[model samples]
Target: MTLKHTISIITFLFALPLIAQEPDPSEAFWNRLQSHCGNAYEGNLALPEEDESFGGKKLVMHIKSCSDSEIKIPFFVGDDKSRTWIFTKNNGILTLKHDHRHEDGSEDNINFYGGTASNTGKANIQFFPADVATQKMIPGAATNVWWVTLDDKTFTYNLRRLGTDRVFKVVMDITKPISTPEDPWGWVD
Candidate 1:
């Protein structure tokens, strides 16, 4: 081959990786969340009027377990340790699921209801609309939408039920991570 053609080929090969590179917000968010593994933070109800179960309680979220595909965060409300938030990434799509357990480690009747993000979303936020499983589990929540936002100072979990007046929000202080709390109900360790 001519020198000019060889140089052109080399240049194109060198630029191939860069040209193929695309920013992935889901991966960024997942890495940011994984960074908090083994830490716990405190939060308060952003919409106290909407959630009585979280009112007058000390709310804590512990990034207790993490893996390549999933992360399990235990959410403690005062002495109640029955809730866990599970985040999973599959084929570039992110999903959020709620896992509830009784004190004896038994799964709650209402559990594993959540949604998957439409795409990579943004580096700091992701919106999850109720999935088929969630809709099947709770017909009334078929229109539920959940979103989580993360930034330098805070991480927030929010929910809104379309066609209803239900909303819940919790904002945790990422700047002041506290002592990691106990495992949620049903946690083996």
Candidate 2:
């Protein structure tokens, strides 16, 4: 065989294993997270975030009480901005619901709900909120784009204002689970 042809054959053979490798990291990560589909925990998050509403100021938020279905989070910003995250999973779709209110019980800047992400529900560290329409938004509203990252036991979220380039990040450490159903927000009588 010609030298060039021989080298081509050898390269092809070597590349087969890489292509045929057992599961990809992403798949493995997804599977691992699926195991914790019904578990919850508590932890802390520390990250820098910026937004136009705050005049390009970055602040830290506190997170608590985490379960597969819901998470309670408190913002470090003044005025008692605390929120609860209700997550629902169904047929591989993970949805997010937000409720931020003061002690007096008033709406907190329009609670966010119906946010969806891939739902293997694994414990793997992952990043999300990958919609371009949501990434560019202005203040006073939540953008279509939101990102969440999970690492073993920590979860982080990145959000943008609706219509501008303002970006905000929230780091969360789960405290405990309040429920166990995969889809607590599912339709029920």
Candidate 3:
């Protein structure tokens, strides 16, 4: 065989494992998020028409902390840095939780409200229906379904309350990362 043929055969052999690997869209999603660690982005609300607290305030998302299987992102509404988003992966399942704290760094009563993905999404989108804990904590939101989508230039977080007219969405520009904010509430230096 010619040298070119031999080189082609070697390259194909090295790629066999990846070619035979099963698809894991969740992992792809996780990696996409992990790539944004230590960066911050500005966003705007695109639902509910208007809001008292969130309206007219600058919205920001700081993907400040990241690990192999966990990522913590702080969501800031103007000066209120009380909400953080925690994403975790275990046994190939992705989970999302809300970590809320007060200005004094005290945990809120209604915290960690989220759910795990249903493993029925693509690499750029994932849906997480409200889990048992969320239902028990906020009975009125029993039908809430949260989802996230990451594309080349934008990252969006959305919520839909099934059987109701409630919904929320925030679209952040990932293509333009802003300066990282200070540590979020309750987070020690």
Candidate 4:
């Protein structure tokens, strides 16, 4: 081979690995969330006033634990009961299984089920609760529709009821840092 041709081939070979590595858009978001394991953060649900015609109400959830596997968040709407959601990521999609049970290991108002939460570039989170058969349980129960600008520190949901055009925009803001180096997941007893 000629000298120029040999140098060209070497350059191409060196650049192959760099060219193959593509940046994952969800990496930053995933890393930020992963750091919140075993930590709790308080956030409020802000709903638009115009939606009051449909009887809108703001809700808040206390995120007790967060990890790559599962997230345990407690919704403090009316009762002190917590909803420990077990998350399983398949491919690029994330499925959160709702385990509605008390701290004593008893069933609550709802039973076990799986739900899909879509992360669209942190622009918003769309939740669709599914049945055990993997069908839509709630026609439109998505909540906390958040703005894209706050994607780094917050998440929003667009909640809807079954067979209804009424969409409630609820926002959840990350308030305080609850995770530390000592115990991030809070798994320790």
Better candidate by TM-score, 1 or 4: 1
Writing each residue's lDDT as its tens digit, candidate 1 over 1-189 gives 999999999999999999668558898899999999998999998885656689878989999999999999999999999999999999878999999999999999999999999989998999999999999999999999999999889999999999888889999998998987777889975
* Model 2 residue 125 CA deviation in Å: 5.5
RMSD of 1: 3.8
Model 3 has an lDDT value of: 0.90
In model 3, what is the error at residue 177, expressed in angstroms?
A: 1.0
lDDT of 2 by residue, 130-161 (tens): 33332233234434455566665556766655
In model 1, the runs with Cα more than 4 Å from the true position are 1-22
Off by over 4 Å in 4: 1-28, 48-62, 102-104, 117-150, 161-163, 178-189
Pairs of colliding residues, candidate 3: none
Query: TM-score of model 3 relative to the true fold?
Result: 0.88
Indicate the worst ten consecutive residues by lDDT in candidate 2: 180-189
> Candidate 3's residue-wise lDDT over 68-186, tens digit each?
88899999999999999999988778889999999999999999999998784788998999999999999988899999999999899999999999999999999998888887889
Error of 4 at 20 (Å): 4.7
- In angstroms, the error of model 2 at 181 is 25
Error of 2 at 24 (Å): 12
